[model samples]
Target: MVLWVFGYGSLIWKAGFRYEERLVGFINGYSRVFYQGSTDHRGTPDYPGRTVTLEPSHGEVCWGVAYKVSGEEDEQIALSYLEVREKQYDTKVYLDFFTDPNTTTPAVSGVMVYIGSPNKKLNPNYLGPASLEEIAEQIINAEGPSGPNRDYIFQLENALLEIGCEDKHVMDLANAVRKTLSEMKMDS
Candidate 1:
């Protein structure tokens, strides 16, 4: 058995599991946003950090990486690892994966993607929408077991760039986080 898993967040840069193949691709009808609260990874319950989640948007394409896990044992191990790591993402969907956003046909189909929803009931860690500055400020100050929240944004920004995909939302937030960190340092 073979399984394709999509990684739009930390998975892009830090897919901790073993996979046979990796492909850069985009999933349709979803725009990535820093709306999910990361209490476990990037911050604490008292001060949760923002992370990426797919918000349904027509004509939108979120680019990331797709890892191919082959062998029944490897697929099971990968899925088990992912289930624990991505516990916060309450929804899992298998969607067609495309190499290009403008592509008429998908390069791979039935790729599994973990999604965190805006509904508070479904995703208790949903931070929802905030102004750029507000989100940046939160990201700048929050830290958890994983590391600093700002580092998450920076790493994700760099990872996306490395893949030759530029996400404006990620870029803008990364810039905001940088500016916010700079201003805080100057004020100190």
Candidate 2:
């Protein structure tokens, strides 16, 4: 049997999936944004702040990468993905062919990754009502096992916008974070 997986946000740039093709794909009924903070990449796992998830129900397009997995290494690939995706996101099995009708990519099937379950422990809204800039700053300024979450957010945003997603909520949140961070600079 063959397995496929889809990546929208960090997965787009990150994922580290092994498969046949890295075709451009899209996932509907969900859009990408810098809403969730990553602990492994952005924060600490003990705090476990790093993660990606859909916010409410927004109808929009999101650019992503799809991979086709097969062979003896398939389970290994999935295990690695599960490790990176962590337990916060749901790991549901999905077909690997069929572009999102709303987004319009080539015909293909793959697994759609999402936050595993709605556990209040998963989301604490710790950063408060900060804007995109503030969030971006935290990501950049804050040290993580990797680098900064800000870079990840910016890259993902760029990827989405480059594909013409233009999610209003994503834009607004990013803008707010930027504004707050900029003001803090003046104050300091």
Question: Candidate 1, clashing residue pairs?
Answer: none
Off by over 4 Å in 2: 33-37, 45-51, 55-61, 90-106, 121-142
Scored against the true structure, residue 94 in model 2 reaches a CA lDDT of 58
User: lDDT tens digits, residues 26-78, model 2?
Assistant: 65555555555556566765543323565434665555677667776875767
In the range 86-127, model 1's lDDT, one tens digit per residue, is 999899999999997666899989999999987789899999
The global C-alpha lDDT for each of the candidates, from Candidate 1 onward, is 0.94, 0.58
Error of 2 at 8 (Å): 1.2
lDDT of candidate 2 vs native?
0.58
Point to the candidate with the largest TM-score. 1
Candidate 1, position 66, lDDT: 97
Q: What TM-score number comes out for model 2?
A: 0.70
